[model samples]
Target: MTPSQIAAFCLQLPGAREDLKWGSNRVFSVAGNKMFAILDFLDEGRGGLAFKVDSDLFLGYVDRPGISPAPYLARAHWIALQRPYPMGAEELRAALTRSHQLVVARLPKRLRLGLLLDPA
Candidate 1:
């Protein structure tokens, strides 16, 4: 997805918010301070996208062309895509949604309830 599209989709998630961090990166977070995705504008050439993936699926994702373990976050199972083209747009959206769900699942019970997220 394009940067604008990504920003829009992320902001639409329950209780999601965006902050500009490190000057050129857009950080999308839920429950206030926990980040789920990042769009890096200053990345060399055409920018990049990074988000957390299920720990069990992390290696599989990074092995794909155009994707790699996200710098500094790989131990937590985050992955970076040089661009979002390796996957179809719908697939990318689903991944983003899963990333949001994963982050939400770890949030405090009160915070999750405040966001009106189901306990699934």
Candidate 2:
């Protein structure tokens, strides 16, 4: 999916917000602090997208075409899809939703409760 599409999908999740970092990369985070997805836009051309995954999913995805461990965050079970992503729009959106859930689950109980009550 395009970066704009990814951003749109990610924002559909509870408390999801987009932040720009390293100038061009769009970072999607929930519950105020934790990030679940990133869309990297390079000066030369379109860049890849990265998100967190479970260990089992990480292993399975890394072995697939166009998928790899995310730079600097692989040890935490994050994965990246190279530019010209192999997955379809729906698949990418599902992954982003799951990643957002995973991050939200790790958030403080009070904050998580607030998000659930009012996911603005």
Candidate 3:
């Protein structure tokens, strides 16, 4: 997927919101404020989308072509999936869902429950 395609995919998630925190680089975060996707590739040359993932799962995608640990966030569980991959839109959407799920799982129970109850 191209940069715009990736951003669009991220936006398809429930209550997903975009913030251009890093200048014009759009960051896709959850309703509860957890970041699950970073659509920085649009303005940052050689940029890629970052998704939260477990180490083992991170390694799986990292070993694949067009995917790697995000530059600075690798140790903290972030993976960069480049465009032009063979993965389809549904697959990417599922990955983003999983990413959001992982983040939600790590938050406090109250916060997680609050997010679940949010209408957004």
Candidate 4:
């Protein structure tokens, strides 16, 4: 799918929000106050998109056309996936769910509880 299409897909998750951070070039989406995906191609070759992915499963995506280890965050458990992949929409949705889950897993217990209990 296209970049905008991918970005829109990422934002479809419940309570997802986007912002132009990292110099206002990339668009990042967060869930439960945790970032799950970021748009790195909005500018050009200077930036790359990153998603919260498990290190073990990360290797599977590394060699994909536009996929790679996210810059500094890669070592901290992040992967950059280039848009327009041959991957199907179902696979993309699963990846997004995985990314969102990874971030949720890292949140503090109290914060996690709050997110679960708070309904607005």
Count of steric clashes across candidates, in order: 0, 0, 0, 1
Query: TM-score for each prediction?
Result: 0.93, 0.89, 0.78, 0.74
Per-residue CA lDDT of model 1 for 13-120, tens digit only, reads: 999999988878899998779999988834943658889999999989988998889898889899988765588889899999999999999998888998997565
- Sliding window of 10 residues with minimal summed lDDT for model 2: 39-48
| Rank ordering of all candidates by lDDT, starting from the highest | 1, 2, 3, 4
Candidate 3 residues 10-102, lDDT tens each? Answer: 777766788887666678887546788777644474545778886678778888887877887889778876656546778877887788777
lDDT of 2 at 112: 83
lDDT of 4 by residue, 1-120 (tens): 566776787777655678766565445554334677777644464434567788787777786766777776777677766545546778877887788767766767666566562222
- Which order, best to worst by TM-score? 1, 2, 3, 4
Which numbered prediction scores highest in lDDT against the true structure?
1
What stretches of model 1 exceed 4 Å from their correct place? Answer: 41-45
Error of 4 at 64 (Å): 3.7
Ten contiguous residues minimizing lDDT sum, candidate 3: 111-120
CA shift of 59, model 1, Å: 0.6
Highest TM-score: give the candidate number: 1
Instruction: Give the better candidate number (1 or 3) by lDDT.
Output: 1
Cα distance off (Å), candidate 1, residue 47: 3.0
Each prediction's whole-model lDDT (CA): 0.87, 0.81, 0.72, 0.66
State the weakest 10-residue window (summed lDDT) of model 4.
Answer: 24-33
- Clash pairs (backbone) in predicted model 3: none
- Assess candidate 4 and give its TM-score to the true structure: 0.74
